[model samples]
Target: MPELPEAETIARALAGILPGRVIRSVTVLREDVVAGSAPQFGAALRGKRFSEVGRRGKNVVLVLEDATRVVVNLGMTGRLVPGPGPGVPPASTHPAVLFHLDGGACVAYDDVRRFGRLRQLSRAEWTRWSRQLGPEPLSRSFTGRRMRGILSGSRAPVRSLLLDQRRIAGTGNIYAVEALWSARIHPRAPSNQIGDAGAVRLHRALRRVLRAAVGAGGTTLRNYRAPNGNEGLFQRRLHAYGREGRPCHRCRTPIERVVFGGRSAFFCPRCQPC
Candidate 1:
């Protein structure tokens, strides 16, 4: 589950390798892995030079010389890495698509579950889709007051609200669980009932955890790694996520797990009281 931190790490890695590299050819290994006609997708990107690489929420943004934006939503188990060449075996694993660059370097897109998608969009299309997502949590505009407003009208569980991309972008299950735990808030607490102080605490915790994770190259629980094939070190510093039976670092209370909305949330029962 590559959340904002994972996506940010990938975008940073790509930024170092992709920009100014001209695409000589594109090979789509799995037709279903991409949106629309895979052939057309490849043709559109061929001969285009990468102008920039960045992230919007949890998606990786690739800006091309022609102003076409290639957005990759690495749903669940997707990865993008720069490799040697198409003829050479990938350093990490086989790829779904390969973008052969001018100097024999290549960029590979790999997704084990095939849930991720690669889409080519015009500037107008990118702007429209981006507007539909909530504010980037790491942005300066996403203040505690803004977070309170987002939760004030919702009756959904706080954890669910955190996972809602339309309500708060870039947070998936892992970061949501960690943020809630860090704030000492119960996952089942009603969003509208969290009050202003609690919202501020949650907001601060979210930003802290996300920044720390990004600095550490994101968490690599499984099937996640930087483009350089280095696993994230943040997973070792996690406080609550995936620590159901483990002791809480802050409190000696055993961490607990609960399932709702088809996802599991981990927390410390005593520290995050209902």
Candidate 2:
């Protein structure tokens, strides 16, 4: 899944290039990939000019001149790439949707698994939708104290709590594993048992890993690319999450992998004690 860093990178890149560009046309090659009426989706976007581009959690927010918002959730294998407009051929073999912009520029939304969604919303609807999400992990509102509060009563695994979008928006499996490893917290540690000290460490680790990942353009294990079709560099900096049986960087113990809820988690047994 494209997580916070990936979304942030794309939004930042689009923010620089999308504003003032008018949508010359809309192409829905895969209607099932769209959230609402396909025809209405196209009608709402065509001829509209982008006013801003931002990100909330893992979703890309595109605001138009008329205050309309388009939210894109790049579910599992989605890529939003920018390049020459439609006739020139998109970066993906078959893009789900294409936003044909002026000046021969274009943005393509492609998902190999067809699990991503593109939705159109009004200003009020956008506000309501955003409210349902928890505080942005990178925002001031998600302080260490706030993180402690989030963990105060939950019995779920700390890793699971971090993966909860309603508890910490924008955190996904990979980042959760990385942050837990960084904080020296075992993935299966009960959230409620993680006292203030653990919460504070986790809070800092989350910010550090996420900020670093954003700077590296996000961890691209598979199918994730920046708006310019560039692969992220953060994957090389990974300390855990895929280095099973590899020597731990800190204690020289072999990193181990565990599976819970059908997801794999990697950690150093000595570094992240249960």
- Per-residue lDDT of candidate 2, residues 92-115 (tens digit): 765899898987778888889999
> Whole-model lDDT for model 1 versus the true structure?
0.91
- Colliding pairs, model 1: none
Alpha-carbon deviation at 61 in model 2, angstroms: 1.0
Query: In lDDT terms, how accurate is model 2?
Result: 0.91
Candidate 2 has a TM-score of 0.96
Estimate, for each residue in 31-127, the C-alpha lDDT of model 1 and write its tens digit: 8888899999999988999999999899999999888999999988899977755456456464788888887887789888888999999889999
- TM-score of every model versus the real structure: 0.97, 0.96
User: What's model 2's lDDT at 244?
Assistant: 99
Clash number for every model? Answer: 0, 0
